[model samples]
Target: MKPKQTLSWKPFVLSAAVLLILFPFVYLVLLSLASEWRFPDLLPSYFGLRNWATILGSEAGLLESFVSSLLISLSVAMVSTTSGFLISRAVFYHPKKNTLTLLAYFPYILAPVVFAACLSFFFLKMGLFGNITGVIVAQFIIAFPYALLFFSSFWNKKVKSYEDLVATLGGNRWQTYIKVLFPLAKGLLLICFFQTFLISWFEYGLTSIIGIGKVQTLTIKVFLFIKEANYYYGALSCCLLIFPPIVLLYFNKRYVFKKLV
Candidate 1:
């Protein structure tokens, strides 16, 4: 007879964790639509669409800030993902994989504030201060590690066999990568793109310090509003800021779960 599987606590544990994670998101949605939110109420006194309308209809450059964030984030995602893929590919195929992997992971291990401070000096000396290009460069640096780490792991495991098989079939390295390796890595690449996008989108300190006041992102806008006690509007801004990542994840839900599992 086949052995019976034991009933495990894993399902209960996972269900609890899922609910814990989702509780905040459910609360945020509630708060965003709340018309009369107050502390000690345990919930909003009233609920309406006014908060969403006020933000979506406002001329406070709210839309521009959204557009700016999208543009910067997409730019950072594309550049970092592409650059990281190339760098990780080089490192993976190098004779000294451990050494190169260490180099790739170093940036990610550093403190963000410390890294931003170091980058600030470089931007100042290079006359790149207070510019979008400077901000993009900084975001790229910060996002590269995430892309590299994800792609590197996927490339090593999923594409290694195909890579060697292609080599044995007389295909050159470049052709093999384009036709074989890249296709297998596409899902992970998409995941990295979304990850890098979120990193750039929510990043505040580096963008603020590096871009000064000339460049404004959604995170910076939210921070400013909060400082000025614009609670309702700030909540709206925070809701808008979270939409992109939510959308990205929604579309990539299958791939995300596959990777996680």
Candidate 2:
């Protein structure tokens, strides 16, 4: 008889790693479905769709908050990615490119809470305080510079050479971008959109300070539940919060990273 083969540790290690990564998400889902789960109970007294169903009723404004977060994130990502890509091009050609790039890092120097507070006065003066638009603008100020910096690498001597070649071939700036640059930068654009969307999506500090408890995005709702020690509802809110990022990650892996690979 052949000697029994020793099993590889790699598979077990991999499985453990996978479990570690998935445990939080799985526990969150379980918690969301649990009711009256408390100490020494081994498991919840009840588990089902009861907690999730609360979103449909007015017991929780979860659905509304979810919609609000989705809209705000989408808006911030679109505007930031587009403007960043365009402005990065101008920065690449500017004599003060270094200075401009440095300035892009300004918003990041201060803590997000302090940054929001600094902007609060302007927001109040502009009649933007405690509203959705104010939160968007505030988040934009942070997200846009990030986008500008992110796309900086997309423009360089090679890209400039391509632009010149297009110009020589009778392609105008619009045509050059439409036909050459956008195609070249499509991957980066999608990635930046995803990044900026996440920035706005999970943003708590700025949204809280700027909105002043009015524009309650999903993140805020999660905090509110947790603050009240409503763990069951908080878990439910957490599940809702994690849903979009999970969807976005799936698509990013399937469509974006797959193509890049």
Candidate 3:
């Protein structure tokens, strides 16, 4: 007869950690599907798609908010990433590169609320207040600098050598970027876009202050739901919130990270 096999604790530990991480998401989904899930209940009194069905009508407005947030975040990410990549190259070759790089951190020097307060006057003067455009521009201000700093590290001595070699091979400045630089920095660019997208997606203080409560991104909607003590709607909104990031993560891991590896 064989001796009894010992049970390994590693699997149990990993399973516990994974459950801890996933519990909030699972609870959110369940809560979104539930009604009358009051205190002291091991399970919800009712759990179905009733709460989710609200998104199909004007009652919830979550669908609109989700679409608005997606558009704003995608715009901010694309603009910030492209501009940051192009401008950082110029900064890399500037006489006062360090000074300009230091200036890139200016937006981060203040809390988002204070930063938004300081910019409110200009936004109002430019007729950007209480609108989607204003929210995009405001988020850009915060995300752009972050993208700038992120891509700044991509321009270094090795990149310079590649640029020189490209020039030697009869490549123009544009050709060097299109052929060599862009391809080499493909992974970094995708990562930066993802980061900037998340930054804009979750931005609240600046969005609220700059938008003057008119622009309702998902983040703002989430807070509104919580403030009203509507847990069902809040959980539903949160489910919508994490959906985009998870998709991005899946694509990044499958395409960008695979190529990177």
Model 2 C-alpha lDDT versus the unseen true structure? 0.90
Q: Which residue pairs show collisions in model 2?
A: none
Error of 3 at 119 (Å): 1.3
* lDDT string, candidate 1, 1-261, tens digits: 999989999999999999999887776677767756666788778787877765566555678788888899999999999888878887777789878778867898886657888879889998878888888888888899877776656656547778788889999988997898678778878887888888999899889888896887888888888898766667777888887788888998777656554
Error of 1 at 93 (Å): 1.4
- CA deviation > 4 Å runs, candidate 2: 1-7, 254-261
- Per-residue lDDT, model 1, residue 70, is 89
- Model 1: lDDT equals 0.81
Worst 10 residues of 3 by lDDT: 252-261
TM-score per candidate, chains pooled: 0.79, 0.92, 0.90
Query: What TM-score does model 2 achieve against the real structure?
Result: 0.92
After superposing candidate 1 on the true structure, give the runs of residues whose Cα lies further than 4 Å from its correct spot: 1-23, 34-48, 54-58, 155-174, 257-261
State which candidate has the highest lDDT: 2
Question: Which pairs clash (backbone N, Cα, C closer than 3 Å) in model 3?
Answer: none
**Where does candidate 1 have its weakest 10-residue lDDT segment?**
150-159
For TM-score, candidate 1 versus 2, the one ahead is: 2
| Model 2 C-alpha lDDT per residue in residues 163-215, reported as the tens digit of each score | 99999999998999999999999988998899899999999999999999999
